[model samples]
Structure formats: structure tokens, C-alpha cells
Target: MTFEHYLALFIAMFLVAVIPGPAVFAITSASIARGLKQGVNMTVGLLLADYLFILLAISGLAVVAEVLGSAFVIIKYLCAAYLIWMGISLLRAKPGTSITEPKMQSTQSAVLSGFLLTLSNPKAIVFYVALFPTFVAIENMTYPDILGIMACATLAFGSVNLAYVYLGSQARKLLTTPRRLTLLNRCAGSVLAASGVTVAVR
Candidate 1:
């Protein structure tokens, strides 16, 4: 992939990671209620889940892309539609509620919970399925290329997530105010929708 392509992928993944979601709340809450170690474990688990989704997307969707070929054009529009829908929904969402009770009692549970929480969200898998073909030429995609994508994903996802973990209580403060929360949602939604449109028309 060209450097531009890699940079675009990184930005997309970063947007996906920074948006507040259940996983984000879980990781932050784990850190606040338990410890940084627990939060780190959960982050690791989430990263592993991401890798799993990436692998599945590559192995399964690559063939479909290869056989169907031009059909991926349709898939691109579909993925773009999904992203737009998600963005709109996020935009309309009410201010996020605080995670008062940390459901994770132990580090093992924290990690497991993070994994299951991520796995349960089929959205990320579909995102990867849609994302790979749009950015990388599936026919020429190699193992190293896949690894490179995963590395970008890891850096993007891990950095934002770990930042939340590190911020801990401070992160919660940023979200506590309705004004700040609304602004966050707006910025995230706009970026998400714009990204979708970019993918669709690229």
C-alpha cells in the first residue's frame, strides 16, 4: 500500500477507536474501579478481539472479493451507508451516562468481559470486512500487507484506549458535563459521516 493509503487507514481506525462506546466505557471503568493493570488487560483483550475480526475479514471477505470482483463496489456503498447510519445515530444519542458500577470484579473477568463485549459487536467485524477491500486491493493483498493493516489498527486502537485507561478519572470528568459530551458526540459523528462519504466516493 502507498503511504497515503496507510495514513488514511490509520486515521479511519483512529476515528473508530476514539468514538465513545461500550468498550470505551468498560475499559475506563475497569481502570477506575479495579486498577490500571485490569484496564490494561481489558485493552489487550479488546486488541486481540480486533485481530480476530481482521483475520476473519481477510480470510472470508478476501475470497468473496476475489470471486465477485466488481461486486465490491456495491459492498462499498453498503458499508458507507452503515457508517452514515451509525454516525447519525451517534449524533442523536443523548449524553452518555457514567459507568457507576464496574461489572468486572477481577482482572480475568475484565479481560474476558472486554473480549466478549467486543466479539458481541458484529459491527466491528462488518467494518473490517468493508474496510479492507476499499483500502487494499484484495487480489494483491499479502500476509505482510495484512500485518501492516493490523499494526496500524493496533496502534490506533491501543493508543486511544490506553489513553482512556491512563486518564481514568480525568476522562470521566471530560464526559461528565453535558456540553462537553455533546461536543464530543458531534465531532465524532461528523468525522464518521465524512469518512463514510469519502469511502463511498473514493
Candidate 2:
């Protein structure tokens, strides 16, 4: 992958992490409820989920790209539409009221909760699969490209999770407040929308 593609992938992945989706909610709530240690443990679960899903998406789509020839390009537009729709939904949604109290009691449960939450979220698969082609030509994907993609995902997602944990540990109220959450949601929405437009235009 070129530097531009790598950078785009990094930004897209980072925004996804920052946007406070299911995974973020799960981790942040744990951080708020239990402590930073629990949150970090939960992050391990999410890391596992992301690794599994990224591998699945890249490998499965590589086959589709190989078989569909130029027809695979259609998937790009569909993904663009999906992203824009999500952006609009976030923008329209009401501000978050509070972080739900997480009830995981053990280390195993904490990790399992996060892993299951992320793994069960179909959106994770769809977004990763769809977003790949936005910066990569799956037909031309190599082992190194796959490795780089996985690394970008790990760095971006892991960093965001850690930041959330640290911030939530210090002042859980700061990020979970209605007003602050609203601003964050809108900012995330704008990033998502712009990303979609970029993908579509390309």
C-alpha cells in the first residue's frame, strides 16, 4: 500500500474507534464502573474480535474481488452509501444520557463481554469489508498489504480504546455528559460523512 492509502485507512479506523459505537460503549462503561484495569482487559477481547473480523473480511473479499473482475467496484458505492447513512443517523440521534453500568465481575467475564459484543456486531464486519476497498484494491492485495491493514487496525483501535479508558478512569463524567457526548457524536458524524464522500468521489 502507498502512504496515502495507509494514512486513509488509519484515519478511517481511528474515526470508527472514536465514534463511540457498541465496542466503545462496552469498554468505556467498564472503565467507568470497574476501573482502568477492567477496561484494558476488555480491550483485549475487542482486539481479538477485530483481528478475526479483519482477517475474514480481507480474505473473503479478496476472493470476491478476484471473481467479480470489474464488477467488484459496485461494492465500493454500496459501502459509501452505508457510511453516509450511518453518519446521518448519528447526526440525527439524541445525545447520550449516561453510560450504562457494566456488570462483569471477573476478568474472564470482562474480556468475554467485550469480545462477544464486538463479534456479534454485524456492522463491524460490514464496515471493515466495505471500507477496505476504499483504500485498497483487494484484487491486488498481497500478504504484506494484509499485514499492514491489520497493523493499522490494531494501532488505531487499540490506541482509542486506551485513551477512552484513561479518560473515563480520570473523569468518567467528562465524556459521558449529554452536552459533550452530543458534540462528539456530531463531530464523528461529520467525519463519517466526509469519508463517505471521499470514497464515492474516488
Candidate 3:
């Protein structure tokens, strides 16, 4: 893939990562209630789940892309539509209530909770499968290319997540305010919607 493509992918991933979603809420809540260590374990679980989804997206899309050939364009538009819709939904969503997570008593429990919480939202797999093709040609995927995408995803998602982990109690305090969370979501939604428009028009 071109460097420009990779950059776009990274930016898109970053925009999504910056949004305080389910995973973020969980990690931040755990950290706020417990400690940074618990948050780190939760982050680890979420990252592992992300790795699985990325792998599935790359491998599965490669075959589908190769087979569908020209028809894949339709899928791209559909994915773009989904992205735009998600963006609009987030932008309009009412300020959410404070996050509440089960007390994570141990590292294992923390990790497991994060993993299950992420996996429970199977729509996340759809996010990976849908978005990857907008930035790279999966039909031409290689081992190195796959590795690069995974690395980009890790860096983009990890950085924002770690920032949240570090913020810890402070993040919890800020997020307790619905207006602050809504503002964050709006900023993220703007980026997300613009990205979808870019993909659709490109």
C-alpha cells in the first residue's frame, strides 16, 4: 500500500480510538476504582481482542475481495454508509450516564472482563472488516502488509488507550459530566463523518 494510504488508515483508527467507547469506559472505570495496573490489564485484553478482529478482517476480506472482483465497490459504499451513520448517531446521542463496571478484584478478572466486554460487541468485528478495505487492497495483502496494518492499529489504538489509562481518576471525573462526554463524541464524530465522506467520494 502507498504511504498515503497507511497514513489515512492510521488517522482513521486514531479518530475511532479517541472516542470514549465501551472499551475506554471500562478501562477508565477500572482504573478510577482500582488502579493503573488494573487499567493496564484491561487494555491488554482489549488489544488482544482487537488483534483477533484485525486478523479475521484481513484474512477473510482477502478471499472475498478476490472473488467479488468488481462487485467489491458496492461493499465499500455500504461500509462507508455505515461509518457515516455511526458518526451521525454519535454526534446526536444524548450525554451518557457515568460508566459502571463490576469491581475487578484481580488481574485475571480485569482482563477477562475487558475481553468479554469487547467481544460482546461483535459489531467491532464489522468495524474492522468494513474499514480495512477503504484504506488497503485486501486482495493484494501480503505478510508484511498485514504486519504493517496490525502495527499501525496497535500504535493508534494503544496510544489513545494508554492516555486514558494514565488519565485514570481524572478521566472518570470529567466523564461523569454528560456535556463533556457529548463534546468528546462530537469531535470524534466530525472526524469519523469526514473520513467516510472521503472514502465515498474517492
Candidate 4:
């Protein structure tokens, strides 16, 4: 890909990443509830899912995805259930005698949670499938072109998610008391739950 092509791809990905969606909600909540490490872990998982979708699109599996409409719907519901369950779990968590309560989630668990969330978002798959063809000349696309696009995606997505992690971690610092922590937890949980409901109903 040329420098201009790379720049355009980066711009597009950045525009999309800056929009808070289910994946962003999950990552920020995990960061607020846990810490920077979990947030980064989740970001890695999400990046992996993006790469997978990109591969699928490049390999002409987007048509397959579009054909399996019911499968996507099932994935959406599964994602909604998981989000609601996670939100409730956060709601039930009691603040310990500390500014930041250490979470029980392992690194592997965080990674898996992120992977599932990203994989379940059918819209993301569809977006890439449609978006790529507009900028990428599929008939004459090269390996380097694909690599550049993937690199752009990683940089844009990671940059935005890490920004969210920093914000959430900063918010955690302000949550010095149990009361504030509880309130933050409830608010974040509600947003997540609501996002899930919106996804399901839409």
C-alpha cells in the first residue's frame, strides 16, 4: 500500500474506534473494575478478532458470513447475554477496603472475554467486509496491502482502547471511597447492560 492508502485506512479505523460500542464498553469496564493489565489483555484479544475478520474478508468468506444470517443473530444474542451477566456481576461486587479492589479474573480469562465480545459483534465483521472493498482494490491487492491495512487497524484500535483504559484507571483513582466506587460500578454496569439490551432489541 502507498503512504496515502495507509493514511486513509488509519483515518477510517480511527473514526470507527473512537465511537464507543460494545467492545469499548467491555474494555473500559474491565479496566475500571480490574486494572491496566486486564484492559490491555482484552485489547489484544479484540485485535486478534479484528485480524481474523480481516482474513475472512480477504479470503472471500464475507459472502459466507452474509449468507449465514441466522448464525450472526445467534451470536448477537449470545453476546447480549454475556454482557448482561457481566454487568450484573459488576453490580453485585462489593468494594473492598482499598482504592482499587483486586479482581479475580486471570489474564487468560480477560483475553477470552474480549475475544468472545469482539467475535460476537456481527456488525464488525460486516463493516470490515464492506469497508475494505471501498479502499482496497481486491482484484489487484497485494500481501503488503493487506498487511498495511491490518497494521492500521491494530494501531487505531489499540490507541483508542488504551485511551479508554487510561481514563478508566484514572476514574478508579478518584473512586477513593467505597461509596464512590459503588456508584461508579453501578453506572458502568447499567451502561453495559443497556448496550446489551440495545443490541438484542435492534
Tens-digit lDDT track of model 1 for 68-107: 6565466556645644654565567666532222343366
Task: Name the candidate, 1 or 4, with the larger TM-score value.
Answer: 4
TM-scores of the candidates are: 0.60, 0.60, 0.60, 0.87
Report lDDT (CA) for all predictions. Answer: 0.66, 0.66, 0.64, 0.76
TM-score for candidate 2, residues paired by index: 0.60
Count of backbone collisions within predicted model 4: 0
Scanning candidate 4 in windows of ten residues, the lowest lDDT window is 96-105
Q: Per-residue lDDT for 38-87 in model 4, tens only? A: 78998888888888877777777578787887876787787788678767
Give the per-residue lDDT digits (tens) of candidate 2, residues 106-193: 7776676566556544456567667766777766888998889889988998999999887757654456567876765566556556
**Model 3 Cα lDDT, one tens digit per residue, 65-182:** 4576555456446534644654565566566532233343467766665554454443354467677677888788888888888888789888888888888756545555667666
- Model 1 / residue 43 / CA error / Å: 0.4
For TM-score, the strongest prediction is 4
Worst 10 residues of 3 by lDDT: 96-105
Candidate 1 C-alpha error for residue 122, in Å: 4.2
What C-alpha lDDT does candidate 3 achieve relative to the native structure? 0.64
After superposition, candidate 1 runs with Cα above 4 Å error? 61-107, 169-202
Q: What is the C-alpha RMSD of each candidate to the true structure, in Å?
A: 9.8, 10.0, 10.2, 2.5
Best by lDDT: 4
TM-score of 1: 0.60
